[model samples]
Target chain A: MPDRANDPTDALRRVDLVLRVHDHQIVGPEGELLGNVDDVELAEVDGRWLVTGLMVGPAALSQRLPGKLGTWTHAVWSRLHPDREPTPVVVPMEHVTDIGSAVALDEWAARRLARTLGLELWLREFVVSRIPGAKGGSSDERPGDLVESASSEATEAAEGGSESEAALRPRPDGRPVSGLLGRTGLSPDGERLGRLRDLWALGGPRDGHPEPLRVTHLEFTSHRLGAELGYSADDRQGPALVRAFFRWLHRNDRVVPISALTGIDDTGRTVTVETTHMRHPFDQ
Target chain B: MKKFFAIALGILTAIGGFVDIGDLVTNGLVGARFGLSLGWVVVLGVVGICVFAEMSGRVAAVSGRGTFDLIRERLGPRVGLTNLVASMAVTLLTFTAEIGGIALALQLATNVNPYLWIPVVGAAVWIVLWRVKFSVVENVFGLAGLALIVFAVALWQLGPDWSDLWRQASRPLVPHDESHTTYFYYAVALFGAAMTPYEVFFFSSGGVEEHWTAKDLGVMRANVFVGFPLGGILSFAIAGSAAVVFQSQGIQVDTLGQIGLPVGMAMGQLGLALVLLGFFAATFGAACETGLSVGYSISQYLGWQWGKYVEPLRAARFHTVLLLSTIVGVGTLLTTVDPIMLTEYSVVFSAVALPLTYFPILVVANDRTYMGRHANGRLANTLGTFYLVVVGVAAVAAIPLMIITRAGQ
Candidate 1:
């Protein structure tokens, strides 16, 4: 057993032996009640499961409850505050700035980080894209020629129309879409590459901004083993056999840099990237 | 005229597809034992289902994601997984009972052993899941299920005093002979039967499968609002018929055949035949629903590709789960476990599991992030909140009542 309490690193010390930080209180630099940790956001890098961020907000707290009670809490909250965007506020480790008695963060920096959560990217990329009649030339709508409407329609369709924007920003509910942990990844050529299993981010901000932590590398997997629990990412954590099984399952895991991403489809479901920019981070 | 026909078709099918084996058995049992005293629970359950189904259907139409998908997303892994496990367990159990119901309905027609029909029914359900179009499957069975309206017709044919049946239903109370615990126990069962989680699962997933858009919201709402309450009337009819035929003589309804006995007595062989046809279709439709729901909740949780809209080969894992669930259903029935008993237990368990499925949908329905302009209105919120409280109370009371009544002896 590892003695995390005696660990020199503050972040490492805050996390117990199990590394379970859920329900831990999150506070600002001056100890303001930002929220409690609803879930831990993780990313895969070099065969490791590193904590990427903490998900907070009422939505996050609702998720912390184990079972239908969580759902009811979320539902009641949603109904009572429909105008508030239901997305949980995510504070990436980059914006975490400091780790101490309260998982401290600069208030403004944390709010800024919340806007660019992987969850919101997921909502824009996957959920919003699948909205029926959301875009033209959809799977159902074959673009039979009305040549004039076709061009504008093509542009709108390529943009995933205005719906993607609506999804990125909350509409009636104040909830901003965040968290993109489980969205499927599609190549630039529309070949089904794999699911976006996890993201890789450098710890802390570089140049006074957390942009360096803006998903430096996206881990994609054709397998489902690490999609939920992220077991494949941390190859060394689980039992040897289980770890070996996940490694075998995710042997084909591909890591692509953010630079490779070209245009996300209008529906926001698929992220298109130039394969030329694909650098295998694992080989490093 | 064409639009009119389409709307009418939607409404007819909605009414027809409403009742399943749960409703049939619970209503029959309630009617025989409590004599319409528990009828109010059906009304409340139906309203709850309509409110949630409309919300879920709307969410699916607008967001193109099903209930379990949103549930997992909103609730995170642990809670979502627990909900998935609980909801799937009940759904799979319901699936088993539905398959058993189909076999029993077959036995009613052929006098053959129900056990023999289990494998055959399972295979047929799998085949339909494998080959049928989403719409065709829903339409065929949904329309066929309308044959249950024969129960209402049979009740009419019985010439019971309308005033007394009305009085019994209007006055909600425990019967003199039945304990309050037993009465409420069956009330929860009736509520569970009417608002089984799988119905919303099927409804929302079906909306996504059919690619419902904002334009189709009217059709979907019509199906839920008008059709479901009218279908609730069918549940009342089943209960009412039993109240007239069996309540006076104190005949307890325990078998699938006993559920149809009221119809058999009122309309003889032909009415019985029609009701059996209704039984076969209703259970088979729900069997398909519950089976697919098991796959839906699991696959949606894991973020795997799912639904019949995709080719079976494309969703191999989903198809695999469906196959395994069907096998389990068949195996359970092969143990000679009584399906009617399963149906009884299923409703009670469903009551316990109610809050799990219902809460997520209510949350997602109110989610402005997803619903946009289609989010629940004030009226919807009021009714939804009221039902949430009712559902919560039933959920809390279900287990104790079950134990106290010894699963409603």
Candidate 2:
């Protein structure tokens, strides 16, 4: 079988991760419902920042929610956690096989992990399953050979990660894509440019598999009204009126390469970058 | 032959399923009070709904995502959640009104109190939602809803002066007795009833449930372009009949029976029976649609498994939402609030919530990433933009008009 990861036309290349991936539905290989890409885990490894995992569930989603709603969601999620310390469910990036209408995860991993959905499982066990016709037409039974091959492939993938490789892998600090969004962008001379609107990422083949997207550029925009409305890209044609409106709204947005970014200060919520490297986002 | 039957059935169901309690009450009330002067609003609304509904349906077919999914994707979490709450509240209100409508329809048939029938009607709706196949639920009530063609028949049987109705509709003049504010208020209500957000939610989500692809786009468009306008004719027939019977006499339409009274006066008990059946099927069908819409909006916004195509147990969260919404609808109805009044408020509020539901659909439909070569062409974009302005005006003006006119007195 051809490896989808190494396909030259992979969807992740030269894409805005927040626009295409964030808040997208996550599905199993056979398209069973799982969850969503509630938040994305980012880690700095070998001097490059790469997406490490896709976080799922309310614990991850709460951070992306605004202000009081975010705090309330976090409070409720923490109180309901079975463990003393609760962490959001993170699916390793390696398990993702495709990114299109949905983020498709590998078969065996998705099946096993679907059990971790707290609310779905609780409702299934207590409420829906008890209904007389609840199970009608549910084709949960899969062929044994398919399951066997999937499990073996999963094991091989797991065994391939040796202790030496683990040691080299950077721990995913609690920094999520949502944390960087809306942070003020500052020039080295302490001049405020704009707010961080989105991140641009590029995907490539590495280590015999497709590497997770590495963040390549930071987009800063003075106005945030049409951030994900697809009008920022010159190729997005639409009703001339709406397209023109959004284009004018985001005309001041700028993109600076990661090479120009000096530091991201989470405490102060600012990203300091070299001003010389910045350019208009729509400029080829 | 099979494809032909499918197209015919799709169009038939669309025509049948078009008029819900909102359309019935708003049109009946508007006809009796203002004559057919507000008919142009219905025309504007039908066109507006067609423009946006086609976009939403096309987006669902090509992108495999429903309306709320795209709403959240484009608007982000904060603004998306606000839209979700507003749209969901309106849909829930409509759902409650639909359930009450079913009870009132039954009251008309059995001459029993509608209050006693509310719980029973709620349970029946829930059972159908739980057990029936998606297509069956759509087809049976939708086809049964075709019994509403009696409104047109009764309108002909009444033998009203057609030119007078045409003159009233064409001139678009407010009657001397009615203030301009009240006249425009009913126009907004009529617009809201025609383009209720739940219809798009249900249509687009239903498209996803049926797994429509680019191949089915032809049939989908046929359903919208042909079925919905013909259904809009049924809306006009209801208004024309009410205008003939009650406008001359100055009797305001405040009850479902009174809305059907013109038919009874024209064609005796037989017309009354078909009208009652039409009332039951239309409201019951809409109850199912609105109930599913409530579930669809919340689940799609949250990215949970939704749709009746999945086994009930598999979509536990979606079904749980459906169950909770049903309970809430029944409880609200049990409070003995007038269903017709509830229907009035629901349509006006539907107008208030229109732009939030529609703007995202327009943006996503034009997005090449999702629609590819199928993105809006010049004609569609022109119509889409025109309606966006119309919808925005109605949305902004709906509340103040309601307050000023005291909900059309």
Candidate 3:
């Protein structure tokens, strides 16, 4: 990449760093990457126009001007960079490969750019790789989140159910849902369990189990599990642990308990909802 | 017909829900100080957020990516990291204020000291974050926040001469009571309030959470295009009332109780109760949004496990951050710093961070590779470019203005 060490005084200069595949925006300087920038990496690597780091800054500008002048650049940038972690807003020149709206970069910027690569490589191998059931793929491999992170749908369903709680019904939301209202239950994580699914009343007297209940578990979409949901008789946590040995392995299905679900209440509350404790309903 | 009514209701609820700690504190302070002279700023801000939020929502729907998810694809790690850090700070500040605001609202209604309620309110927020369904928190709180319509009711009740109110709103200039320095400061504050970072964070993130695919783009756009401006209307209502009632009285709105005075004056007890309900819901809602934004950015950036969809123990780190931020916000309020003041600093600081986050968004949105056929259209690019300039100027001058006006003292 063009090693244009940005001068302290010359403010309008653009410096090139290498782009990695996994770059995304965060809420601030400290958060994780929010998304990736599909862009051209134009930098002079060695002597050729081997594109370097991709350009990602304010929609206002291509790259933020560096150093003090750039300091007066944006409120968010200033706050994130406030005299604390002044990690230069730069990636090295080695990681990038192509250029366009979506520029592909080397999988690991740390691997190519580090002057002291041996140590980082070793630690990545020894410490980082072996951090107790760590997913050891290059950061680029898992860049895109497959599903929604938060579920406003589930929250709204709960709220609506609560509002109509007086109607002793089954689950409020549609779909096959078991009632977890009045019965006490254990959490998947052993914490005090809350409500699970409120089956709604299809058409009955103002009474209990006569109503159909729709289940809306805690926000446990496939996205949360970071894997696909598939439960088999032989498929146990033991195999799941072994499956995790492969960095790319992800079992989408998570285990939810049948009993932890409290009885369905006419009030539309799904009590004894457990998120973390593990019991195999299939096994049960 | 019922579903349509619900959608319309959803849209209305979104309007009220859009104004959070950022809007409440920023607009209130500006109205008291700058009067209706800066009404234009809120308009501009509403338009700006609509443009971006629509793009983000569309992107989320079509691409199945959250706002931060898109940011990652468009910006590389280094620059993306920069965006993450900047966005998180602003979100956290707003989060702090939102929690504090919730406490303040409770205090207002109960007449109990706000400090005593801070911990309880904080815990309640955390509990909701922990177990409550995401939609329940959003739709319910969003609908409940419409209680703020009492501000408009109060304005009507105050019976500010329409001609006078119209003239004041129309003649957009620095008022005689405030110096130009303070005038610009409050103007920027008003703009900052309108475009406060958390709103976008919440909007885009909400898009992803709702499983919006490109097919849902129209719905997303409708929400963004319609939701935010309407929210801006609520903000203006509050500020205009203050401009009418408090300006003549020389009463600057430094307290939550006083912010509701217009409602009290116009609609008496019912209005006051509704306004307080609005306050509780808005602040409480915003606290949840801001708190989630913090976690969303952190997890999305690192490619770590994240999201409420996961069991708390499953996404340990993400939950840890969420839990930690709630504690910090409560702790920050416990220091006895004014919630209003915290919100003020948060808005001003968010203004400073605006360019950093929005700039990359504009660039990425315009790019063809990631967005492909979905790249920004001419209208988007033009508006995006214009806002970039506006944001650039604001970013450059925010600090100097803050220092000059002493945070609009």
Query: lDDT of each structure?
Result: 0.71, 0.85, 0.58
In model 3, which runs have C-alpha deviations exceeding 4 angstroms? A1-284, B1-6
Q: Give the per-residue lDDT digits (tens) of candidate 3, residues B54-170.
A: 766665555445666556544543466678888888788889899989988898899899999999999999888876777788888999988888888888878887887677778
Best by DockQ: 2
Chain A only: give the TM-score of model 2. 0.81
**DockQ sort, best first:** 2, 3, 1
Which candidate comes out best when scored by lDDT? 2
Instruction: Give TM per candidate.
Output: 0.63, 0.93, 0.62
Question: Under CAPRI classification, how is model 1 graded?
Answer: incorrect
Task: Assess each model's interface with DockQ, reporting 2 decimals per model.
Answer: 0.03, 0.39, 0.04
In model 1 chain B, which range of ten residues has the least summed lDDT? B363-372
Distance from true location, Cα of A114 in model 2, Å:
1.2
Candidate 2: which pairs clash?
none
Task: Mark the 10 consecutive residues where model 2 chain B has the least summed lDDT.
Answer: B366-375
Instruction: Give lDDT: candidate 2, residue A81.
Output: 57
**What docking grade does candidate 3 earn?**
incorrect
